[model samples]
Target: MIKSKWTSEQLAWKIRRHGVEMTHLSGGSHLGAILSVADIIATLYTNVLNYDVKNPKWEGRDRFILSKGHAGASIYAALAECGFFDVEELKTHYQNGSRLSGHVSHHLPGVDFSTGSLGHGLSVAVGFAYALKKDGRKERSFVVLGDGECDEGSVWEAALFANHFRLNNLCAIVDHNHMQSLDFNENTLEIENFGEKWKTFGWNVIEIDGNNHQELKVAFKRVEEYTKDENHKPTIIIANTIKGFGIPFMENDILWHYRFPHDGWEYDCAVTALHQIKPEGVEDRYTPNSIENPVLPTEKDDINNDHTFSHTWNTTYPEQMRRVDAKSGTNEKVHNV
Candidate 1:
C-alpha cells in the first residue's frame, strides 16, 4: 500500500536520478530544466490530480498539460510513479523507435496533450476547460509554462481568451526561472512586473516558492477553492524556481540548459546531491484508499504509442500522492516535498 504522506523531496530525487540516468543512456540535453520542475510535477500527481492508472480514459480526471514539453523526461517519471506506466520503460526514452521522446506526446497514456511548441499549451488547456464548462463537467485543467516561453505572443492571446470567458476551472503555472534558450530572460526580453501583467489580464495570481511542497499544496487548494466560487476569473501561479536546480555547478548556468553532463565527476556530484535530500510527506487532510494490484499493458500495441499524449479521468482517491520537486536557486540546502 502506498503511504498517504510521501516526501516531495524523495520524488524530486527520484526525478533527478531518473533524468540523469535517461540522459546518460540517451545522450540528450535538457536534464537541468527537467530536474528543476520535478517538484511541481510531483505535487500535482500526488496531491491534486484525479486519475486512474487502469482507466486512463476516464472522463472525470483532471488534465495537466506541460506547455514546456522539453521537460518530458521529468513528467514521464512522475507519471510512472503515479502508476500511469511501467517505470522500466523509461530506459527507452529518446531511444530510436521509442514512444518516449524529448518532447511530450499525446500517445503517452497519462499525457493530456502533445506539446513541443511554446505558447501552445495554455490555449489548449483553456479550450479543454471551456468544453468541460459547456458540458457541465466539474473537471479542472492545469498547465505548466516556461518563463522563457512567455515571450510568445500566443500566450497572451490565450490569457485574454481564458479571462474573457471566465474559465475559472483553468489554472496555469509559470516556471519563473530567469534563463531562456540563448541568454538570461531579463537580458533577452524584459518582462517587468510579471505579477501585475497577469493580474491586469484578469487572472487571480498566486506567487509561491515552487520548491516548497507545503506552499505548493496550499496554492493548489486555494486554486481549487477559487474555482468553486462564483468568480469567473482564471488563476495563475507564478512559481519562482531556479534553472539547473539540483546540481550545484549547473544552477543558473545558461550552458547547462542544453548541455548534458559529460564527466564522471559531474555525474557523481549529481548523485550525491540527490542522496542528501529527503522527500516530503503528504498532508493528513486527505486519506487514501488501498490500491489494487495494477495490471500491466498486455501488448505494446495496446499502448497508445503515438507521439501525442493525453490523460483520462478517475473519480476515486488512490493510495499515494504523486510527488516531484521544483528547482530552488540556492545550493545551501536541498528542499524536498
Candidate 2:
C-alpha cells in the first residue's frame, strides 16, 4: 500500500468536497448519503484499509465494501484521492455510459463489490471474512452500511451467520444518519436501539460520532485490538451522523437525499460551503432532458412540482439540525444559516 500524504481529516474534507461536485456535475442523488458517510469512508481509506493503487486486486489487500451504495460517489472520491484512478474520472459519475454508476460498481479499480441492493453487502463481506479466517489470512473484511438498510431481513441473516462462526475479522460500520429515502427513521420503519440490535445478534458493537475523526480513529483501533484475541466476535461500529452534514443549508435535510446540486444558487452555495472553488465548464455539460423522462425531472421542477407518481415528497426537517461550520466543514457550533 502506498503511503497517503494527507491525514484522515484532510482526506475526509476532500471526499465531502468531491462528493458535492460529483453529484452536482452528474445530476446524481444521494448527496445527503455521501455527506453523511464521507468521514467514515475517508477514515477507512486513510487510516485502516491496506491496498495497492497500482494493483487493486492484490490478494493481501483488506476488502472494503460500501453497502449503502447510493453514496458511491464518496468511495469513488476516496479512491481517486488515494490515486487508484485519475481524480478527473469523478466528473463522469452517473453520466451516460459511465462506469461510475449511481450505485457502487465492482468495475471500478478499487471497489471490492458492486452493491446497489441494500441488505446483500453484509452477506458478501461475511463470506469474505469467513473465507479469510478459514485460509488463515490476516487480511480483514470491512463493510459500511446505512441505518435505514437495517430494515432488510437479509442483513440480520448475515449478522447471525457471521456471529455463529466467530468471524472476528469482519468490521461493519453503520452510518446511522437517522433519515432514509422519504422521511426520518422514526417515521419510516424505526430501528431504535440500533447498537443493541447488533449486540443481540452476538457481535461486538462500538457506538461513536460518525462525523468525528477522533472518535472514528479510536473506534477503529479498538476493532483492531479486539480481533487479535483468538476467541473474538465480529465487530460493528454504529456511527451516529446527521444526514446532509457539512453543507450548512442542507444539514439534516431529507431533501438532499435525492436532490442534486444543480447549476444555480444550490450548486454555488454548496461548493462555497465546502471551501472549494466551483469547477469551470459545467454549464456546457449535458444534463438529462427531464421532460422526455417523466420520472426524472430538472432540479427546478423537482423542487417546485410534486410529482406524486414518483412518490418523492419534499419533506424538510430544518427543525432537526447539526451545527457544522461552513468554512471548516466540521461539526462545530455555528450561528444559524
Candidate 3:
C-alpha cells in the first residue's frame, strides 16, 4: 500500500519531472496542458475515485476518460504513481511500438478508454453513465475535456444528451487553461461564459481552482451528494487551471504548449522549482480509519502493531485467502477477478 497521501505540490513535481522526461525521450509537446491538469488528475485517482490497483477492470470501479489525449504525459505519470505500471516504462512513451503514445491508449492497464480525437470523451462518458444507471450500478463516470475542444459541436450534443437522460452519475471536468493549439481561447474562438453555458445546458455547475486539492475534494463531495438526491441532472466542474501550472517560466506561456524542452538548463530549472514546493496537507477532514492508522506502516510487522490482534486477524485472513487463490490460478484470472 502507498504509505503517504500525495499532496498537490508533490504531484505537480512528479508531473513536471515526468513531462520533461517524456519530452526528452519522445520529442513531443503538450507539456503545458499536461502540467495544468496534473493536480486534478492526481486528486481524482488518489482521493476521489474508488479504484483498485489490483483490479483495474472491476465493474464497480469509477471510470475516468481523458478527452484531451494530448495531455497523455501527465496521465501516464499519475498512473505510474498510483501503481498501474512501472514508472521506468514512461521512457517508452511515444516511442515506436510503445503503448504509452502521445494520446491515451485503452491498452494501458488503468486507462478506462482510449481517446485522442477531440470532443469524444464526454459523449463516451455520458453513454457509460447512462448504461450504469440503467443497470442500477453505483459506478460514476468522469471525463476531462479541454476548453479548446469544446468548440467541437459533438461536445454540446453530448451535453444535451447527458441532460436529457438526467445522468447525475456523470461528471465532466473542463481544463480551462485558456490556450488552444494556435492562440488564446478568446482570440481563436471565444467561449466567454463557460459556466453559464453548462448551466444553461441543465448541468449543476461548480467552478473552482483545479490545482487546489481541498477545493476539488469539496466539489466532488457536493457532486456525490447531488447524485444521491432524486434530482438527476448531470454535473460540470469548471476547474479554472493554468497552463504549465508548476514551471515558473512555463506558466501561461503559449509556447510551452507546442515547444518541447530541449536545453538541460530549462529542464533542470523546472525540476528544481517544482521540488521547492512542499506538500500541503488536507484541512479539517478526518477519516476514522485514517486516524486509527495514521502514518501508514512501512512494513508488514508494523501493520500488525498499529491495530489490535483481532482486527489484524480479521483483515489478514481474507487477504491471505485472496493470496492463496491468486497463487493457485492464472495471473490473468487473478488480476481480473
lDDT of 3 by residue, 270-295 (tens): 55555556344422111112222223
lDDT string, candidate 1, 193-269, tens digits? 89999999999999998878899989999999988964579999999888778766567766667767553545555
Question: Candidate 3 overall Cα lDDT vs. reference?
Answer: 0.78
| Stretches of model 3 off by over 4 angstroms after superposition | 1-5, 278-337
Q: Estimate each model's TM-score.
A: 0.80, 0.82, 0.80
Residue 101's lDDT in candidate 2: 97
Q: Residues 204-297, candidate 2, lDDT per residue (tens digit)?
A: 9999999998999999999999889757999999999988888776777778899888776677667666653222322211222212222333
How many residue pairs clash (N, CA or C atoms closer than 3 angstroms) in each of the candidate models, in the order given? 32, 0, 0
Candidate 1's TM-score: 0.80
Two-way TM-score contest, 2 vs 3, winner = 2
**Model 1: residues with Cα > 4 Å off, grouped in runs:** 1-6, 278-337
lDDT to native, each model: 0.77, 0.84, 0.78
Question: In candidate 2, which residue pairs clash?
Answer: none
* Weakest ten-residue segment in model 1 by summed lDDT: 282-291
